[model samples]
Target chain A: MARKLASEDLTPVAGGGLLHRRLFLKAGLVLATAQTATSLRAEEVAATTPRAKPEDPADPSWIHKPGLPFTGYGTPSKYEKHVVRNIGGNRTPQGDGVSWTPLEELEGIVTPSGLHFERHHDGVPDIDPAVHRLVIHGLVQRPLEFTVANLLRYPMRSRFLFIECGGNSNAGWHEEPIQRPAGSFHGLVSCSEWTGVPLSLLLDEAGVDPKASWVIAEGADAGLLNVSLPLSKLMDDAMVGLYQNGERVRPENGYPLRLIVPGWEGITNVKWLRRLHVTDAPAMTRNETAKYTELLPSGKARMFTFVMDAKSLITSPSPGQKMHGANVYEIRGLAWSGRGKISKVEVSADGGKSWAEAELQDPVMSQCFTRFRSPWAWDGKAALLKSRATDETGYVQPERDVLIKERGREGYFHYNAIVCWAVDEDGTISHVYA
Target chain B: MSMLRCVAALMIAVSVASLAVAEEDTRVKGHIDGAHGSAAVEPAASANMRLGTPLTSDDIAKWDRTIFPDGRGLPPGRGSAKEGRVIYEQKCARCHGEHGEGGTSEELVSGPTPPSPDNPSKAIGSYWPYATTIFDFVRRSMPPAAPGSLSADETYAVTAYLLAANAIIPESAEMNAETLAAVRMPNRDGFIWIDVKK
Candidate 1:
């Protein structure tokens, strides 16, 4: 029998009504407890009962239906149309704009190809693959021009990685949390399975001169965007990606060809790439000089600080969301590091006073997304929840004040501090400096 | 009979002349229409044609768009600080500022120190490490709205003005492609190498 609730029962969680931040995994409180139970029963049946070999080829499940047909291109399921990147372009110029990926609504690591974030200075160029070519010139032993077909024939590997725009989270430098959705605040970053040939392979094919230490990568967009990358990184884990999320790259995300610099900002991973000019030194492009440079308190500027530090954020129970009741819940989110694998993720229910180790999902690849989960109990009390990720390099995420103090108040780019969420008595959640 | 014969001859001549004119009109119209048709679907235009003239070693013999950490990517042009001042007023002052100062939304010529845990200021004279970066950046994207539009000479003039304003280059010194590539920046050695040693 369900008891009628009084109006007073809907009181806030605490003074701020923030929910209990820690995942208090009580009995039977897994986020997917209902589904897990069924799977667990299936495992038990297989272990205890004698298994009989199936004689019939036309099983009931297979006889009635075959799988969906193949498609040249694919879109998200009908139920997932709401998960598209929140595109916002300039009213006058249709091509100039950005789209924020809905990070909070997604689960696990892979960001479906359709939902990858976009930051285009100019409009997306409709390039014909037939005529596309990648030219390697400048300080190389031999200049080579490879068509799209030639590039596809090279050996390739797949990696689950994240590419974040350098300007992302620049809004954090603003005075307030800029209330919106969690995605808008942190959506500029997205992770996907990128498959491509190693850039070193192509550079080797071009016979990079021994003195060539830098390469100027240029894109074919209207802006003719170009930037210089250290040859060391090019020879490292960098890839000339041809696929994203197990399919040919999307036009918005550098279809036909693109460069993937693992763990670096998105700008360096140029889209619609057309040329790479090996050079002895940096090109000092506008991106490296005028923009993406941070002002330090020590009377110096931090220019080519490329690697994105370890960062994590709780998605559900985040801002603009709420809790149902004093029931058990699953606290889940994603953590990643540009330097390497995420070592551990810690969650705090009462601000940063208490932290508990959350379970990291398996198949944790380097420079890839690592999903984390922990159980929590909401005792109808206000609580603050937060997540902090520590990378394999033993670099613990810094607090807001730490980052600000180190980088100075003028610092805007690479804003990766721990994120906190506060739940009110009415179960409404919002961003909090705590 | 003579009047009837004359009328028949006039009608035949008019018909033949009109037929010739119609043929000429069809040929002219067909050529004009074909010339203006959309080429996207036609696949006749070749993008592989060399852009501009073929650049050989000889053609690039004098073009020195290269930069080292010290100074580089400067084009073959020269400008005096005095000339730069006049150029700045006519071209740059509207957006940049009167005395190498910055405008709203534009970075000031002089600036903050390198980014660190404390003081964060970004400016050309104070923070930039290599003088070459300034030349590269100005040449690639600058003047706000009109990027890659400045002449090689104008680019050198603006670069000289900026360097002089930053107190790097002497006020009376001249900056050509060769001299510009020799100027040094304040924070040239102020970078932390990623310690991913094998």
Candidate 2:
């Protein structure tokens, strides 16, 4: 049996609508609602059940003894051990696989460095920064080689961006709805504050030749993973990421150095970056022509389709979560666009029949995750929920049918469609195509 | 009364001197270079900050293993499918299967079947656009356990074996840096680049 929630328990914000609680927006700044929700629930629990003090001359267990000494590094609490990445890999070859970030269990826009999603071709190579060198050659006036110390001296910039796998959310193309947690299906994307030096500064020093158009960025992994990127894009905003969040980048996420192509596909952001060879033509690597290319309905394969389209997913009220006989629940989700910042996200309670504007969290920068929330007053009835995003470029996320019609059914990558979660009268939530 | 007038004049002079000092302090605090006269002073041009070292041709050659579609960067080596069969049976058959049918890893050959929407088999023959990709991928990362361990001749042999098995090349075809690049893949013209306007 589900415990019923009271409508009066949730106090609406002043000057906001009755049903919607704009908890994210306060004085034009976005407040952290995950912290607020935790504190609010704690307060409600304390008010309902007050604990009596111990009667004897004995102190509480935690207070009776001194706490453990602080360490040089900290870890998540023991209670949060369940919040781990779900590893999905090949059986025979241990390294060739992916580990999905548990997006449903995470809060806020930034994905912790430890819990970030991973997609490796060969494996996570143990690279020593001392010997690692990034050589820039090919069509340049002067070919140069930079060590880890040399790259650190160049000017750098930081950005909050999302790196989504080209194959993220590909289960939507299935004939039947995938019966799994939302994160397991769509957690290939993760956001972080990456700091790095721009590739243009190095190109300027090298004196790029006039004929050079494409730059082949390669990694130092066992696979020697390489991808051809446009020189124009690299000069625009591409970075040689040295740090993730604040500290140095983790090994799995490309330690030593990485090529951070903001808003582009994840594969192009070559990890453990070792070399950049500028050329007038593309290398026509296996990944570019055979793998990442999309099989369109017109029988012509779409190659080098880099930019990730606008997509939004309601993390809560998604599959595997129950309504708990909801009275008033805050529906929260993440929206992002590779083209630019997300302008709006609309939540449809009745499955696209009607939609209401959700409040977008403040400081919504371009090519970053924008947290959105909307208050819903459930009457303990069966309902369907969905979310659609619109980017600053005026491109709206398409529905499943529309996407299938455009890309065809045989597509294996880049599936971004509106997802629907059906809430039954029994409070159980399930995936649906409605 | 004349003595008081002298003191007032002295006080006015002191006040004017302090105001001028304060103005000078403000200018200094603002980093205003008096020589430039504050008309958007440009940074002083200094010698180039040569951060990284210049690499010699030999140093560049060691790490530059990239193989372009036009046959550039292929090492000097030659092999045939006959020679590659022995190596494939011993080293690669465990993962890629006995006849390149694929067991644990990717399938290497698909025979005469073309890739379609319903039956998409991305193998060496059906999907790969360039033959140089086979040589490049095999040379760089093959036999996953011991990658980059294969000799240039061994890589060419394996590439020839895979191409021959897929019926794309003759069984006795000799594969080298130039010949491998000249081998036309079946789906070479199958791809079309579409630049979607954001």
Candidate 3:
């Protein structure tokens, strides 16, 4: 029997009282007082209990009343105050590592806008949007300059997509398992509803020269960051997003403007967008040359790999989550791809020894989030849970060892391998190689 | 019959005039750049910026050091291997290493080998399609922590050291605007024309 936090002297009942994470739809648990009442003999306690009958409903607690007014924007409930993106940096030093995103405490398809993850090379620059100017010069019939307000006047569209850091899941590449919640390992990727004007319109307005085949996109951060992208992709599905969720984007997520290349990794989508210079080829910036470029096992370095392949993760049944002894559990998670739609997702109960197809939720969108679920029965034995996504192009998610063998020990960027979580007999969960 | 024809002609003229007036009104709804017949106009604001304000031109420009595939952002800086060795240790070696071998989470130098379909390195001396990218990237996002803090002279010197270490440039060579732009990369000829069709 268990009691809630407040009702039990501000402390929850110890030892597996927390409900199984797989039970997502239930509001709360049954308390000990209610359970004891059912077990008690009715006649012995009837005189002292003085229980209110069903018809005695004249007065209800004022706390069970109507709530406050509506708001233009929304935030997470006060109960989720501890769920914040943890940022770590050296006080005297800068451009350091940051760990910790509270992935254990979230649910549903969309990540709340405020709790989206961040990784900064330099400190976040407090930019003045008024002074920000987007210059479109170099190899154009008519070079144009646009203020943020000018760009907003154009027609716009919205999409629900995810932006993932290239270095995400680097912990997976390690020899030993780095135990943490799913978010810290994969939180670098977050989904949002982005609204923006398509890149095709701006490219058309500038009148791209016939010889111009590559665009050198630059940002206005203190870094003055720049990288080259193929002109074809830039004009294809790229967007200059200004709004995330239903409101203007937060500063950490690129205030005023950012380039959103659907299905592409996050670095190519420059934030604090400032300039685009049309050119003949890639500038071959350090990021393109030395970094993001991976050396394959055959000794050939894979460069200019722009598209992010299909990937998915089971959020609820993942590691650091608890389980109640042997019952039915509903597996829930999200999947997406940059190439196109996820055609199918298969879940494994014994770590790929046996596979069962999971149910993909309705309204599956291209280059957007597709939630998946599967019903499972636990017979009180140790097992492993894993999911593999196959995209529309017939590319199946590779195993961890397969990716390592092909990419070699030198692999640093774009690690998209199947993830496995081992559930022990005692109901403890952890990352496993499987 | 003549009176009826005259009345019809008069009605046509009146309708045409009203249509012309409506078209004019819609076109000038926001601003009036030019004078049109019977259109309400907004007076133009007076200019404050005077004629003799110093022009910020590319001529005598300070920050034109953004090298592209066609070699545009390279600036005036010259350094030899002997001088570069000092600069490399003082500034770059803290992260990159003593022999340009690279540290953990850092990149190594040395490239210019042919695209190894069997084995690809993609280092400065190997798989880079253009040498100009090295100069451009170093000027922008190098040192990881302190980006865009290097001077033109430092960038050119560092690029020269990396090239020499990668065996592209000789030990005693010096690099400047003209010589740096002229340097070719190994994989420049390996690119395929992959673009989306309209």
Candidate 4:
């Protein structure tokens, strides 16, 4: 008992066969062609989206046999083993590199903690909760230390936020487009619902001295990694994250505790956090002084450039994904902003010639990933796909060329630019600079 | 508690706190000026919970490991680059190379040419803005495999040797708390600190 999808539903909203979002919202409605069938509407949807059907309906093996018993921890289906962290590259100690989240293989906002992208300084330290301690000292009137049990006594709040490495999307700096999967190419970022006590309360209890301008947060990892964070941020929205996605934080993602500085760069969210030294000046740690700092064309480096900025990526129909030849495909993607919420996301199908606003999924939290979707009709011809995001602050994501011109060719960190995917006539898609 | 409740409380807490925080934009620290509405939830009071134990000066001194740029926390010890050469070969040579040009670890020596976009050397001499960081890093996390294993004297020696290798100091010059903190870095003014508004 549903109304037939009108021909107007199949109208192209933009160039390159981009259709209205309502047409492909429901698979049943898209297929339920009534009187419109046998007309031009039928011809328009001739190669409609294909949903899988069994050779003999209701004869699937999974339902006919006895299901296996479940354990305490359940994993994705065996068939989904391909979806995993793309841990690549060679490092000096083999434990110092990053593993990318397979963005193309997942959807929605929260990244599974197990599959969260990881960038470790040395290696994951096996920490004992009983032995782990967080000491708040230096410039405070009374230096205090808290055990895991002590932290549990405090009232906790949770927020969905993203932690993006400053070096993420550096591959975009290459002269030629890196032909990697969207997730592997730009998956060094992930979102999580981190639950913990607001750091302001703890700092208040410890009684912050008036002279302390910055705090040097140190992790308990092998390198004893550290970074300097502005006191304002820690007081505003940062959390001493003890839980990720409702459970105790995964070890690789900072098990016992992680400093969740909301929208700041990942290094500042020191994992396995052990110390917070309030000081009048920054500690000038190696990570703050040399590593996370971005070199500019002016020869002066940009240090403490903390905000991740606004960025968006089309997960499907991007590089490594293929097209079901000449079909009505629903393009899905994600958008987020560090300054505030994402106000809009636009889809360009004809290489930026024309663009249409994408339908944003609900509950678009501030400083968190926002899901976006657009519908497209491919007529077995070459096409280009790109998505651009604008944050609530009216900051639009710049195009690749525009970004390059502003931040020279050499700057590696904070590369938030539009991404383009070129689809060939033969049903293959690859990364493009356009 | 439902997930939505936590989010709702936080959102209200955030809006209220942001308005309260706008006044103290210039100051760095003090008694918590904002974000107090978060505690305004149930329990009406957090000072009553009274978690965490206070530490004496001796207790803080034991765990206070941060090294500041203005000669605040460098431990008492001294070593010359001459004495550090032997320690460097034995403890650091395999990863850092013989001359600090980089082996498996990062390059430590200054560049043969001036820093340019094409040949930007992020070595200790060309990039790091402070000299005390060298001693702090070595003493805390060095050798890659066994961290915090070097003595104060040995770390000072390695810092002196690396400084000498980069031609920032003389091989005979000893590195102590005072002398090491006094050594000025070439790129001390290379970073833009105007973005500290965060």
Candidate 5:
């Protein structure tokens, strides 16, 4: 009586797919047939069973007790304590490394503020907002000094976007596949609703000099991290973000204020912003010249590569998770693009041999995380699962081999390729570069 | 009687036009009042509204510590590698190895060779594009324990020592704003702007 399910049968209708079953429940549709059947069965069971002891002390613990008092600030439930950022720092120096966002543990698009990924050069500086002042000088017609209060007075806009380190997912360039969870390997990117004043308005207030082309944005951290960004880009869509996720920005994520350049690399969105020096040329700072620059196969180093390309990753049933025997499971993952909105995400159960278009979650905004899902029926057979993303620019996420061929084997940053997870007959999953 | 009625009509029209002008003035006043009352309000003309205070030259100088590759912003100081060795032993050798071989922090000097596809060692001499970056970086952030604590002379000395140790410059060479800017790096032409092509 076993029969193979066709691809058409597996494909879900709009808003009526297996992935939207939870959404349907939230929509409040009653299951009349199941409810009536359950009621009749309950009637039969009540007639045969004895009356329960309602007044017994062991019946319930909180029956006659008052609940705990409310707290001013709330935290995640005790059961979710394990959901924390996976810290990966240098052995000698305490805070010289990076912490990854738990991407697999998160649901939907918005990554919580506390669990956002962190990348520190020296370490986080305890900056006082009152003492901190953002100075705009150099080639400007009139140099301006603004406090946090002055910045808050400007017209503000909120946007849901992702900030990804240029060095994120660099493990993919390794000779062999990394066996860690998806989050540990690729969680340097995080999404949030950032509220701030547009950089264009601030620049207009200062009146940028006609000759000024670049703006060197510097952070107030101990490292004095600085990088040069084109004034054209800052005037385009950059923001001086003051808040994150409906609250004041967290300490780890540039408390009080930060610069947010949508769809650009995270380093360009200088956290703990302190200065903006307009200039005719790039400063060619240490970060821009020495670090963050990639050496090409042609014996030339690629500099000022700011934009993060389109990428996707399948979170559930990834490495470190096991699949149950032969049932329909919802394959879920996240897709994002720096060029624009994610146009499509294709899931392939048999590696790259054939792919099916996955359903994208609602409110798929540009330069934001878009959740894509598909339902797959596993037959307890060995299979390879992979997801590839396509952005609005018609750029497809390349395969591991294709990416290696293009970028070369000496890659250290901006490693975005289709990730594959192999599912064995024993129901164990592991990373595979298919 | 007809002439009197026409005059009264003209008077009424004149009063209504004057009232309309008064109402327009009140609306403009209301806009100004709204902008003054709440900081959240968007003013009708942002060009007219002055928000931040204008910075003076001294105030700007305090935070403008950035140094360009052209040596335009280098502070006035001079030091030799010989003088730098003493300071290096006292302050830098603990974290950065005695010969800048690197212990806890990044190695300042490595083998006197450029990085290749096979053996990529991005040390100070082999990779950095500009010599002024050494002065800028050392002065801004060095001795991880206390950044921006080094004296101007100390920073220049350290820059000279690192440059000499990496075999980029002679040990006796004095480093200052002028000399450091003139010294061309080995990898000065190694970089290409990839964004320009895009």
Candidate 6:
């Protein structure tokens, strides 16, 4: 039973032919917009549109014949093979690079487990859970080591959280606006359902010394990647994740264990977690002091910047896809922040000249992706599109110019600015600085 | 949740010589807080869930090799830049360049000056804040392919060679644990830590 809305409800909420937010809530209200769909050729329409069946519908070949047997596991439909992670700078044998999630083709907030973006320093190691162990030492009352079986005995909590690389959208610092897909440019961050035991329980079991204020975490990969985090953070909300998406984690995603630090950079959520050493001071690892740190125009570098600020991106009608000739289309996108839940997301269709609030989907979780959408009417004219996000902390995503004025064009990390896509008159969408 | 008090019933298998296990925690031995009870672990009951194989110093020495910037974990080894040059050319030069000016790998030495974002030369001499990091990184993961292949003395020699090449130390200086811990790089004071009581 689809709900209907009157055509009179198609009122422009903002400038440049934007529709009311309620258009999304009412079922099939898109049909009431003068019955105008994207102008499709008769051949393309006939191929997909269902044909009327005779009184006695005949069974198709798949139904008439015996079906294929079930396999041990299942995979995505072969037709959807194009949907995959985009690997960049791939040097295979001596692994070092990253992969981007194709955000434009995805819908809703939850990213599929297989499509989660990956960044490897020395490639994913094949760890046999039978022999792997997590050791807790340094400033503790007793040094204890636990095998995978031991951790599973502890109580577990599940949460939908996000882990964003500190350098996720750093390309925005380019003097010229980078012309790439939304995900390729800003897909280093990903969200998922993680189930694990609270780290405080384990830390308490180890009995942390009064002198310890920092915890150095290291992975089991070839690089032995390490970083120092504030002790309070691990006790507050960090967990040693044992499961992802209700199943044993994949090898590339820390099969045995991963430190899921909510609202922090991805590197701090150390994967293939092998050791935790409590101390009084930070180790000042290479990642912290040399790489992740940002150099400012002031001739100084900003280090230990753990929290990612508010950011949003309009995914649909973005680069790489051609728009249908002059019709109403839904402008949808994703919004998130490391501080807390996203409070609001405002969309603009005229180069940020006029704005309207997009409807946020339900279950707007903290430190998780929030999907937002708004109905847009295009009259076959050129237009600029953008989305701005505001987290619960009252921090709004800054404009490109505003961010540049404060941080400067020299910054190579932590770039979160309003993204704009120019819709050309020919229905071709492209990335633009406007 | 008194994790310390709950230890009144567990026995740790540790000799008197081991400082790794606190003396007070090894007093008792018995069953862990009802592993047979309902699996739903409430915080009150699970506080007593002290589990894991108590590790002795010998059991962890092989894996506990990460060195601190203050040289807390530096092994008892020493090496000089003159000895390091031979090791550098044979093992490190092909990737890091003959002069450590960077070829296929990161630049290890460069002129000491402030690094601007445009000319962001994050070479060791310009950006790295600690001299001990060269030893720490080289020993932990270097040569990009086979990590942990260098012995402690070789790592110290490479550290000495790089430091001398960067003009931070004398070419003839033999670096030991105490000396390496005290060697300050040019940008040692350039770091600023926030959000903690550093």
RMSD, one per candidate, in order: 18.0, 11.5, 12.6, 10.2, 10.6, 8.5
lDDT of 2: 0.82
Docking class of 4: acceptable
Sort by DockQ, best first: 4, 6, 5, 2, 3, 1
Which digits, one per residue and each the tens of the lDDT, describe model 3 over residues A1-434? 34342333322111112222222223233322111111223335565777676333567554477887787666776744557876643332255445345555565556677877776665566878887767777777766677776666445678888787777777777898778777778777777899987777777767789999988888876667777788888887889899998888878777778899988877888888878878786677766665666666565566777778788887767776666666656666777787888889877878887676777877677777688866555555787888889889988889899988777765577888898888788666788998
On DockQ, who's better, 2 or 6?
6
Q: What's the TM-score of every candidate structure?
A: 0.72, 0.84, 0.74, 0.87, 0.84, 0.87
Candidate 4 residues A16-113, lDDT tens each?
98887656555335421111111324345545746475345557767777899867798997756667899965477766789998888788999999
Report the C-alpha lDDT of model 6 over A1-434, residue by residue, as the tens digit: 46665576567788777777667677455531211112223346667888785233575546667877887688887756767888985653357788888887688887888988888888898999989999998889888898888787676778898778887878888877777778889888878899987888889888899998999999998878888899999989899999988887778888899999888888899999999988888877787877787777776777778888889999887876667768778888999998999999999989999998999998899999999988887777998999999999999999999998887776577888999999899877788887
In candidate 6, list every pair of residues with a backbone clash.
B10-B28
Give the lDDT of residue A123 in candidate 4: 84
The most accurate candidate by DockQ is 4
Q: Which stretches in model 3 have alpha-carbon errors above 4 Å?
A: A1-75, A86-93, A96-102, B1-65, B97-130, B142-146, B184-198
**lDDT, residue A95, model 6:** 75
Report how far off residue A418 is in candidate 1 (Å): 1.3
- lDDT: worst 10-residue window of model 2 chain A: A27-36
> Model 2: clashing residue pairs?
none
Please report how far candidate 4 places residue A93 from its true position, in Å. Answer: 1.1
Provide the clashing-pair count of each candidate structure: 42, 0, 14, 0, 0, 1
lDDT of 6 at B57: 81
TM-score of chain B of each: 0.58, 0.72, 0.62, 0.73, 0.72, 0.71
Tell me the interface RMSD of model 6, in angstroms.
4.3
Error of 3 at B191 (Å): 8.8
Per-candidate DockQ versus the true complex? 0.08, 0.23, 0.15, 0.30, 0.25, 0.26
Answer with 3 or 5, whichever has the higher TM-score. 5
Model 5 residue A310 lDDT score: 96
lDDT measured at residue A193 in model 6 versus the true structure, 0 to 100 = 93
lDDT of 2 at A202: 81
